[model samples]
Target chain A: MTVKELRETVKSLLTEGKVDLVIGWGKGTMPGTSTPVFIDTAEKADSLIFDSTCRNNLSVYFTKDRRALAKDDKKIGVLVKGCDSRSLVLNITEKQIDREKVTIIGVPCNGVVDMKKVVGKVDGKEILEFTDDSKKVTVKGREFELTFPLDEVISDSCLTCVRRDAVEYDLFIGEAREPGSDENAYAEVEEFEKLDSEERWERMKQEYSACIRCYACRNVCPSCYCNVCFVDQNDPQWIGKSPEITDTMIFHIIRNLHVAGRCVECGACERACPMDIKLLLLNRKVAKEVRDRFGSITGTGLENKPAMADFKEDENQDFIMG
Target chain B: MIRIEKERIDEFIRALMETWSVYAPARDGKNTLFAPVEDPAGIDHGIFNTDKSPKEIFFPHSEVLFEFEGGEIKKVERDARPIAVWGLRGCDARSLRLLDKVFGSAWQKPDNDMFEDPYWKEKYDDSIIFGTACNEPRSTCFCNWFGAGPHDGAGMDVKVVDTGEAFILDPVSEKGKKYIGSLKGWAEATKKDVTKMKAAAKEADKAMGEVFGMDGIQEKMADLFLKPVWNDIGAKCVNCGACAFICSTCHCFDVQDEGKKGKKGKRIRIWDTCMFPIFTMEASGHNPRDMSKDRLRQRFMHKFSYFINNYDEHLCTGCGRCVIVCPVNLDIREVVREVMACEA
Candidate 1:
């Protein structure tokens, strides 16, 4: 199996002292989930697995625990999906992590399943097991078996992903699979943009109201690694602490703007949210706008400078009243 | 005891709404949540439990306490109409009683009137809890581990059990008996109907076996403050507050004043979690629980050891919402097992 091959590679890396810790995905507590596991010894490498349920972007650990690992003069290895590798590139460009002190083990993915959609399908039945094959996903419950099309249950970002292979990796497992859907990646945002100003504002308001201020979206994103978030600052409270409608709106709007040109569209924020808010749509919307204005795509390779960090001599400023 | 035919639920809810504003589990798209309903037809009663807890009906996520203008402060008026909460399970109903210990008695606390919170009292004191017995508990449910079961009636005014075709309303409190007795056109429950409810509840209890052994857990965790088990348990935690927010009994809050300069302000109480870095931050820029490991230690210690010292009851109701909604899949049941294995 491919998981065994991946485990053997990680074991050799740990045994050869190439890296001190290997961060990967492990069997989760639920049927259709995977948890991030940190393994420091070769013996624990077997606990790692890569599957459709391995949805977490392990690159978030680069912002955390990387400093301590570097202080000890040890390299750390991280597993990355096609989308997760983009955030790692962003982290490298932002200088949060030294590229020399880390190893990236990328894995080509065939679109992870959106757990909310699966759970919604099996509404009242107790799910006993779940298996994801290429074309079909079977969810076996206590008294029933349900098979759903794989494309229908995948995360929305995965549906239109053009990058199926890693942008940067020392070693990659499995061959790149075909893109699930050929639709335009920005089709949803374009449809949203066609709405009137009132409709757009109302849609944003409804999305923000469902927020519980849990900060899961902020904490889970690899790009959002600020020491003190804007919401937590009390010196001059920028946003209200309460989950009031206006406060929620301002928090989300500012958060999305902060990661405007930097977001990698990994859909980690959307996946991490317990409220099931469609947060990636906003990030994708901002990414589209940034590309339209700057003629650049974020985190494609190491040579490309970030759109926000660089400027052209004759930049177009027609929208800015120049 | 009164028997309500399954078909008469809408009529009963319509009658109940005449006196009290009724809140029940209703379908909101694919998710089920406790929402205010004018008509009972909107209620989704076939589900085992709602995705969100019923605690929000009384203790809202955010609420205004008072308004200040110039030099004067005015307290927010309490809702005059009473509330009837339907579809509360055993764990959720018991969570209310657990919350009452902290917010219930104000007259006899260390500080008399200043610390007394009237907001929780106004909504919770007059509210009636109609707890439904779980006939088919979900796989994530663990209410049985806390010395409660699918049909335990520790804190409910009225205990309801589904008999497949009818609902047997067993009044466990004086308020429940008075309300059910005064209602017209409901048939009295027979002995045969009572037996059916008991048999169904027993089957449910058996289905959800004990996931974690609760015996001696408090003592096992009492003095292991400096042990390495905490590090192992806290390592995988992403420090997201989804566990605390979805929890039925987590009641931490932060009071803040929102206003403009030379403008009116509103003082509101917002739901806060101990998992956040700023929760224990001192005014002098020093944080005692500075690391994620420290914050994770405090969460388990407070639930198992400190709360047992103060309240003599564990704070967790074992609804398992946290287990299900965790982004990184950190299971508290595993935390309990790890704590139980710790050596003194």
Candidate 2:
């Protein structure tokens, strides 16, 4: 949907009282970035917009209290891209969110550009306008021209996505586009298998040494809505809270494994890593293993139990010594 | 059935040494560790179990999937080495068979979109194992709890029993038989040797064994998952996860990716534990097993119930490595007994 049309639709949804609040995108005071805003009144609904600049996954707030007053009810409306919509579907499959409680405004996307990359290239100029057809964006009247190629600028998640269309939604805004290519993501796993013991460990240590344990990745991820994280528990912390290499390693490992067969490929973890930690590799690795072992994928349908949820009688262990 | 004399084990070692990386119980300073044997001249055969199992020989504490430098990917190349663990206690050896249910039998797919592990393959493939029967197991051992004994031939490539100055070697598989036969220094054992070995195993089993209440331990463990005794028993845990780390069969792990500015990074899989607080912690500060009691429950249930549910076998090897290695004296034996006390 066009940005103008999206705003009117949100305004109508708010005025009709079909929803308690319409969660939409509002332009940041600085120009390009879109901050998630709850339009409770007609006046606030005018600020809603749909553009390449609206990149944050609004679904994250639905699981927690991002748009709640102490006394107000928390019914929410969200603008979802294809990938974001998949996350919503998976969350529902996981029972993290209820469909009747959410009003989804689906937005078809070729790909949304990463703001961090755009900011680095923008060189301090404020972004003014972004267009879908021209695939060009104007930053403070300076035209930065580009054609649509998802791999270079879009979130890494959209690069190998098999679905470019929203799986489920209440209101449709735009037409679905073709999916991007299936880049051979498993190539590195094969390469890593070649290393000797000492060399393999040395390299793994170097990679984990950069983690700061900020938890930004977890907070922003739509699926990570647990009441208590194991990392912070005191009485019987399965993993320690010291932020040591071992603790960090255990944190990522258990986190990924718990989500194994259920990670919807949101790419939020990768985006939130201030250290640029490739958390998705952990998720993708488990996802790959889950698919290989069980022949099932997540978010495709709500009926499927997560990989670890219910196992088959014949789960493979052929290579093990018997 | 084959037997090599205890005095002639050196010949067997010398023969097997040619084709495989022969690992035996060796002294590292004062603590016993498993390592590759360099000479048949120096070996210590006193211990029934090594302080740590031979898991490190296959699954190391850590391994790299790939490396990243200046935004370009460099995959870690595997070095070729065939592995053969000597003096593998049946409890430790049977654990490998259990490990195969998760790692060996079936993993769903390729690991990552851009990764597949070769390190796991290299160690798992082209490997032969030599396990010894635990004639005189420790009071702490509970291998019988998992349908195995010191002489269980389920997972071992070959079985070894020490009878005074002689060592008996028996193959468990066709490959094992061929490999044992090809080892030139060893002699073909006679029926008399097998009879002597059986008697020795019986004497050892009668004297060294203790009643573990196995039929009750697994069911009791499942029933006692939420018991208060777990808190009293688990409260001593510092959550260092040293128990899981040193465990002969604990197989939980983590994966890492070292990416460049614009390219995909290397993905790695490393060891992990459920005892540490962060082991269940999510990115959003939510932990399902937020209480130590809950994590402790997971540790035992995974060993007794969940693992059995998954593999139709208890995850514990009953080798008691976790019991011995625990720094705070968190004995799994105490926990099991405590679990047995629970009504469920």
Candidate 3:
């Protein structure tokens, strides 16, 4: 949606006091990415715009502010994409947010390019305007023409998304678009899998070897909801925070295992990592395997039990038992 | 109980693998682990025990309860089925029964539904463990502490004792009865199969190590708060939670808020340990276990005392992974022995 269109909707919602706050995105203090903003008034509503860097899921606020709600009165208006709305459905299943309490304004996302990726390509150049129509993106007054491929560039989830249309929403801001054909969602994992078992172990060891345990990945995951993490429990420390490879190994493996069938694959943890780690590869591996085995994808058929929650008569773990 | 020749073991396992996820000790070079295998033939039968337990398949190291995101709360979704741990030992299998008592019952403190974890339900719901006799017991193996041995089928779905040509499948649970019926290749029990299996158990019994025989571990723990020994023992202990990570029974954890500003990101449950100095620290910056000594005392007391009070079972499974993994080599058995020796 256009900047003016987004602002008008926010203003309309605020004027009616239909919501306590209109959550949106704005430019960040960082060089490329934008930060999340909670627009409670009409004056600030004008700044709410949909941009390429406005990539992080804004739906997280519904969960963060849940404790602040008293007996009544909580109507949150969210602007979401097809992929983002699927999380809303999964969120409903998880009861992270009340479905009736949310008012969703669905945006038909073509795809959003990560500013970090563009910035990395341009060697720290500034982006002036990332025209959605122009596959040709202008940066630092230089025109770079390119076609958007669903696999290599757009949100990785669109590759495997069963809900290319809005899963749960009150209104559609635009007509929905079909997700591109099945992408090689597991190509990276496939590459890792093709190696000898020992090589895969070494690869995992190498990847997790750099973990400093700041928990940026865990803190940023949309599905990683817990009030008391095992890492923080002292009475029986489940896993240590030691920076050593073995502790780090258990941490990374257990982290992935815990979220095996639950991860929404929003790329939040991978994006939030300061260490430039590919945490998504691990999480996506679980998603890929779950999909391959169950022939069911998360966030689709929102009413269906999560992959791990309910089992079909024929549960496939042939890979596991073999 | 049923009997099948040792050479026919692979066929029996393969048949079990059709309906069950066979988790057994498998090796990929140096790292030996208990993993689910479709082809039970690949596992080296000589490997007696796994470095890791089958506990994670039943009671995960970490798991999410539910997520609160974007002013919305999404409950964690899980649907579970049955998994069969093929080579689980007597000690670890018994530990699961203990864990089931804690998580399966409806006494949740803070109200997290991970108590009904889908992964746990799927694998453990109708679990049919096929335990094998530990022919070569490790120095660390101490199933005897809990009134068990290499051939003890206390909690196994089925116990297999190698009778030269065939394995005598001694069914320990109702689940084991159905598992044996499905095996067509196994010969009906001959007295010969039963006798050899018994002979193997008798042979293993001769080598069983002395049990710790420690008592008053729970009785003395109430007075541990007054004890001055926490300092000396906790000094050697680093706050790394590795011991809990490798433990067969430690089940503590915390949740994380991960996501965008408006969206509640992933609410994740991850492995946590009490060994960290700030574990007992409140967010307001007041730490209950201000010094490491208080933290150290809490760990021992909880394992031996508080858990017993609540569940009528000691938390430790006596797996000894903690002893080998502890950087300082602080053995938990030593801790138990020392606590028993200390004056009340």
Candidate 4:
């Protein structure tokens, strides 16, 4: 299998002293789940596995300070899916980690199954095994076998994925496909646009009301690595700590604005949310606006500057008030 | 004991709603959560447990203590609505007992001068908890280690056993007995129904294997504060607070004053987690637990050691929500086993 071959490659890198650790996905305690694995030795590489369940962006670990890895200044190898590679590209451009200090093992992804959707569809059955071929997902439970078309169980971000090929990589594991068409990328936003301002505000209020302020969305996003988040600041106290409706709304708006031109639409924020708040709507709306106004697509290439970072004198001013 | 027919469950809920604000495990989008429900049909039937624990009913995510205007403080009135929380699992119900110690549930003015969480006491005082027995526990459930089981009743007033066609409701306290006796349309449980409930409870116990023992874990944790096991255990943690928010027993909170235009303001209390970097930040910017390793150590240490010293019981209830919702899959059971294996 391609995953096994990839494991062997990572194992060799560790044994050869090329990389101190290979960050990848490991078998989770439950079926249809995968956890981030940090393998520092060739013997530990056998636990690594890559499949549709490998939804985590392992590049986030590379950006964090590592005492052991930094003690000897050894190179770190990280496994990146299609969407996760974008974070690596952004990190390289931002100089969060030197490109020379990391080895990227890029893997072609066929989209991952959304755990929320699977849990909903399984109808309280203990999923024994889950296999996905991009087009369909087969779930085997105690006494029943069920198959769901990819459109039903696939993550929302995967469905609207425009970039499926690895843009930057040290080695490509599977067959690389060109960036697929995302004609319906903003279909949900378009439908949301049909609503009036009052309707939109009401919808946002209802969604934000359920937020418990766990900050999982911020912690999971690869771009949000501020040492002191605005929400955590006490001097100015920009946002309230309470879960008030208005406070929650402002928190989401400010957080989305912070990552405006940088969000890669990986759906990590929405997936990480315990309340199932449909947070991607806010991120995608900002993404769509940035795309239409500035003609900037984030993480597309390292050479391309961030939309909010670089500005032209002749920037569009049609929406500016007189 | 009273028996409620499967079809008349709604009738019981509707009757309770007339007297109290009834909350039940109901469908919220795709996940089941404890929400206020008017119709009994809205209650989730097949779900094992709510995604969010019923603890939120007593201890809300945010609550206003008082409002201040022009330096004059005005205390907010507590809601007098007596709440009825239905469909709580035994693990979740037991967690309330642990939280009671932290929130000063035993405090009285003459007896103890310690601060009392009136907000929690107000909601939890007149509240009635209906605990449901888990016949088919999830693989993530490990309550057997914390002196709790799938069918163990610790803080619940009533114990409910789902018998496929009907429910055998057994009162666990005087309040439960009084409440069940006052309710109408519920028949008295028979000998056959009692036997079925016992069998179900026995099956639940067997399903939850006692694979990991916590016999000396609390004492071991007390001595392993300076050990290297914490460094290894905290390595992969992303420092996300999902584990704390989902935990049934975690009860740390932060209070803040929110004012607008410098005229009127309100002081509110919200949930906080020890996993955050700023949870222990001093006003002088001196943080003792600045590193993620220290924060991770505090989380595990407080649950196993500090709480034991204060309350004589471990703070953790072993509901396994932390094991399930963790993004990086850091299992508390594994962490405890490592602590137990640590050489003192």
DockQ of all candidate complexes: 0.64, 0.01, 0.02, 0.51
Candidate 4 lDDT over residue span A38-127, tens digit each: 798888999998878888877667544442352357788888877888887776777676778788888878787787788679776767
Off by over 4 Å in 3: A1-322, B64-81, B105-119, B261-264
Which candidate has the highest DockQ of all? 1
Indicate the worst ten consecutive residues by lDDT in candidate 4 chain A: A63-72
Badly placed stretches (over 4 Å) of model 1 are A64-67, A70-72, A176-183, A314-316, B29-31, B106-116, B260-263
Better candidate number, 1 or 2, judged by TM-score:
1
Comparing 2 and 3 on lDDT, the stronger one: 2
RMSD of each: 2.4, 24.6, 22.9, 2.8
Error of 1 at B290 (Å): 0.8
**Model-by-model lDDT, in order?**
0.82, 0.66, 0.65, 0.81
Q: What is model 3's DockQ versus the real complex?
A: 0.02
TM-score for candidate 4, residues paired by index: 0.93
TM-score of chain B of 2: 0.86
Across A66-108, the per-residue lDDT of candidate 2 in tens digits comes to 3222124556777787768877777777767776678887876
User: Deviation in angstroms for B173 in model 3?
Assistant: 1.0
Q: Which scores higher on TM-score, 3 or 4?
A: 4
lDDT of 2 by residue, B1-344 (tens): 56666676677677777777778988653245678889976667765577556787777656676777666778786646688888888887777776765666333355523232456666775788888887666655777666666567768888877766577778997778887767654567777777878887777566444656756466677667666777656543434465676688888877655344356656666677887566777767677977656777888889877876665777888887665444334567666676776676
Q: Tens digit of lDDT per residue, candidate 4, span B6-55?
A: 98888887888888888888877645678887788888867776777777
Total clashes, candidate 1?
0
Over B170-218, each residue of candidate 1 has an lDDT whose tens digit, in order, gives 9988889888888888899999998898789789888896657777667
lDDT-sorted candidate list, best first: 1, 4, 2, 3
